[model samples]
Target: MFTHFEPALMKFLRDLQNNNNRDWFNDHKQQYEDNVRTPALAFIEQMDQWIRLISPHYEASPKKVGGSLMRVYRDVRFSKDKSPYKTNVGIQFRHEVGKDVHAPGFYVHIAPDEIFLAVGTWHPDRDSLAAIRDHIVIKPGPYLDAVEHQPFTEFYEMAGNKLTRPPKGYDKEHQLIEEIKRKDFIAICPLNENDLYQPDFCKMVASRFGRAQPLQKFICEALGLRF
Candidate 1:
């Protein structure tokens, strides 16, 4: 299924690592599409099915969630620091765009070396903040046991925006000014270079997605392997 993804995913990671810039990323936009964008969507499509089983209080006819790269340019007019880009995947769980209270979902960071996913009570149509607040407040375990058995493990919080972790206290160690806005997280198990997409690992991940039934089904169907 990810036949079109392997090549581009490989190249984009290589390019992004050395000289990261808007122009650099834009130049290889198509590569990003072939690898990251396309495959991410394909993956998220499977993810949505899982979300359905887990979050029943969702919009019945919701829009397909999407994954996108956060812009590198930070609007300095409001603040001073200008990070060219964020190195994590940010997804919105909604039917469409144009709203701040998008869907609830998670991200996977290629750097600081982490992989995982999570969701809160975010439903664009009904309760956006409520969903997020609930998830963050309860402190749901980011890494499920099944997912932990995979090749990668979800690690400590990535960019402060993913979700709220233990309070930073007065140290102000985190980068983001507004942290509470983020409300969920996920981390994968460890993996070796030669051990990607292993059937056992994939099956374990599929099993952990118990709440996300639709998504689990999609994965099962994709590999012709069932949980």
Candidate 2:
């Protein structure tokens, strides 16, 4: 059974609300480990069970992906929006190894920020990033809709600093031909921290999550708070 969050743990996160900079990030490593990382570890462990129950066909991804804290920088002189910090945490679901950027599914921004789960459209591919390109261009509707409804305040005090847009040049091929994609990503705040726990919305989203791919009941069952 899952335990309720400790008071001390929440207080620690509250303290990080106004904190910033690499020094602050590094200085709080121990607290991060004790309160945040440890809890996140427990979360993933439980999530593994959910994955197996939801998509049995899925071969479990590595247990160690994002197993450690991440650096808050992207060394991209070749591109734009070069920030000094990574605004999100990410975990990949790839069938193959070796930086599987083309493979589908990655969780994002689960620590020190919005704990949103992304189901598609991120590429770490260097040579040929066609699949990722397609995700951003072809099926951008569903993910974009989810992004609009994101509520960062629930997770991060400094969520205002996070990425507001899908990275530059997200649509190179230009195939996002839908009203949903055309709609300005709204970025609505969550009605409640427990919004994810709403049975109606949760069931609706989980049911048609990937269109044609109705999610297993186990997935819907595991996504919300188990009462």
The most accurate candidate by TM-score is: 1
lDDT of each: 0.39, 0.38
How do the predictions measure up, each by TM-score? 0.46, 0.45
Off by over 4 Å in 1: 1-11, 58-81, 92-112, 119-196, 199-206, 209-227
lDDT of 1 at 125: 35
User: lDDT per residue, candidate 1, 1-227, as tens digits?
Assistant: 32112434544665676756778878977876666656656654555554455443322222223133333244566666454655544443422222342333332233324444432223333244343334333332332332233322232222323434433331234333233343322222233322224434333333443434333222222223333
Tell me the tens digit of each residue's lDDT in model 2 across 108-150: 3333344444343233233223332344355455434434433
> Candidate 2: what lDDT?
0.38
Predicted structure with the largest lDDT when compared to the true one:
1
In model 2, which residue pairs have backbone atoms overlapping below 3 Å?
72-85, 72-86
lDDT of 1: 0.39
